[model samples]
Target: MADRRLAIEAWESLFRAQHEVFEVLSNDFVGTDLSQAEYDVLLTVTRSPAMTARLRDVTANMLISQPSVSRLVDRMVGRGLVTKCNDPDDGRGALVTATDLGVRAFRAIGAAHGKRIAEQMSRLDDDELLALRALTEKLRAGVDVDEA
Candidate 1:
């Protein structure tokens, strides 16, 4: 019982720390005006090979609803950050691809975010950080994440 209590406390502490950090980062990114959802889509599209993805792919990758993804994509397209094309593989499917502007934005945001996260992680010793990674990976592996 004590062990379980300790574990739960550790988890809550981790979540609280993460939330605080994200809040700071989000504030720093306010003028850029990228919502968390838009950033997630940008990350997904930018990381994918050729910076291209189908609408369905975004829904699957982001674990978001199709309509939500569509609305986000539509906004992104209007901003000239992304473009929608007819999917070659599926005539009826719409393919989304990041534009040069999108890549530039992603690069800038990713650099700042990476630097902050790296600096925060540097507070931990190498061994402690590695142990945390191992434990988290083990916990994640135990979960049954549904793929769409």
Candidate 2:
């Protein structure tokens, strides 16, 4: 029990540190109209070979609720950043894809984010990076597949 508590606290600390780093990167580096959530959505869609995804897929990938994703997608559509199209295969599902403007915005912001992360982590040696990845993966193993 004590070991679990200690692990939880350590995980929280790591999460906080990562959040702080993201905040700094977000504020000073990626200063575009796109929010972090939007950027993530765009990246997930763009990374896929089809460069498109269904609403449910976006919600799952973004780790957000359906309503939340709907609202966000609504906003993105309003901004002409993305489009909601009827899925040809499934008449009921909507396919979401980034617009040309959305792709442009994503590229600009993503480059900045990548550069920021690279600059921040540049001081870490290869061994330290590997250690961090191993530790984080170990902590991630705590989440049961059944729970997921």
Clashing residue pair totals per candidate (backbone < 3 A): 0, 0
**What TM-score does structure 1 among the candidates reach?**
0.76
Tens-digit lDDT track for model 2 on 68-105?
99899999999999999898999888889989999998
Task: Show model 1 residue runs off by greater than 4 Å.
Answer: 60-66, 90-94, 146-148
Over all chains combined, what TM-score does candidate 2 have? 0.80
* Candidate 2 positional error at 59, Å: 1.6
Top lDDT: which candidate number? 2
Q: Candidate 2 local accuracy as lDDT? A: 0.84
